[model samples]
Target: MSKIKITQVRSTIKRSKRQKATITALGLGKINRSKEVTATPQILGMVEKVKHLVRVEEL
Candidate 1:
């Protein structure tokens, strides 16, 4: 399996609760925070949900 690097490039403050939850689920809370997570369906869904707030790259 491949891995992906997901970076929270934007702030989640003032955003909706769902968005904040998604950020937390992705192990990202502050701007510039990043986490290397496996590429799974659940994670992919979360990434798609907050695609605007993050940057993703394959590793």
Candidate 2:
């Protein structure tokens, strides 16, 4: 599987509960925090939900 880097670029404060949960599931809850994960459907869906809050790079 291809690897994709997920980085949290913004704060989660005042965001919806679901958004925060998605960030946490991605192992990123802080600014500049990043995780390289496989590009599975579930993971990609989660990323899409928080696309504004994160930056993604293919590896």
Question: What's model 2's overall lDDT?
Answer: 0.97
Off by over 4 Å in 1: none
Candidate 2: residue 34 Cα off by (Å): 0.6
Scored by CA lDDT, what does every candidate get? 0.95, 0.97
For model 2, the stretches where C-alpha displacement exceeds 4 angstroms are: none
The per-prediction CA RMSD against the true structure, in angstroms, equals 0.6, 0.4
Top candidate when judged by TM-score against the true structure = 2
* Candidate 1 clash pair list: none
lDDT of 1 by residue, 1-59 (tens): 78999999999988999999999999999889889999999999999999999999999
> What 10-residue stretch in candidate 2 is worst by lDDT?
1-10
User: TM-score for every candidate vs. truth?
Assistant: 0.95, 0.98
